[model samples]
Target: MADVILYRWSTERDTWVSASEVEEARAYLARQGITTSALPDGRFALAGESARAFGAERLVFLGLQQLRGTRSA
Candidate 1:
């Protein structure tokens, strides 16, 4: 299956954190010899055994962005 990259906009930091969870996952995968590539615009590409090992995954993808005075999740 094709790799899916999730995205989320951080209101606290006020920036796009692409594949945010992937980074954390990569750390563990790295120990097992997995390779990950961070793409432009906060995206990530994962390959090798790590991808297969950490294959089944779920992501928040993105939270709503609220205008000043507006609320979003």
Candidate 2:
């Protein structure tokens, strides 16, 4: 399966936070062994394992997208 890109909602900003804005949270997730990558469009992504492990309430499901060029086997 392909990785899924995720966006986090920011109550303070009242919108979805950009990739750069998610760095702090990304770092925290990294410590827990859930690696995420920054996207060119100012979003972040998680692989299959990481995605399954991530359960942050701030994550915006509306913006969740599966990366292109990958298919489930």
Candidate 3:
């Protein structure tokens, strides 16, 4: 399964607020009239007023992949 995560960059705190659920992220984006597109790297990109509406400087989509043939530290 793909581990999809959404993050909004907070300029004030210089950090990010994340949503683990794809549905939640989709709803939030829809409310803000934002749209997402799939990238070639298997990640998503946000467009439109998401940053301003959410009081964030940027919005990012993160797709987590497990490292195969690697030992967990």
Over 4 Å off in model 3, which ranges?
A: 1-20, 48-73
For residues 1-73, write the lDDT of model 2, one tens digit per residue: 0112232233343354444434555665565565676545444567563343332324333123211212232
Predict model 1's lDDT versus the native: 0.36
Top lDDT hit? 2
Tens digits of per-residue lDDT for model 1 on 17-43? 335444555554455454555545444
* Residue 9 CA displacement from its true place in model 1, Å: 18
Q: Give the least accurate 10-residue stretch of model 3, judged by summed lDDT.
A: 62-71
Runs of candidate 1 with Cα error greater than 4 angstroms are: 1-21, 47-73
Cα miss at 13, model 2 (Å)? 8.1
Ordered list by TM-score, greatest first: 2, 1, 3
- Which ranges of candidate 2 are over 4 A from the true structure? 1-21, 49-73
Worst 10 residues of 2 by lDDT: 62-71
The alpha-carbon deviation from the true structure for residue 44 of candidate 3, after best TM-score superposition, in angstroms, is 1.3
Clash pairs of candidate 2?
A: none
Error of 2 at 64 (Å): 17
Full-model lDDT, candidate 3 = 0.38
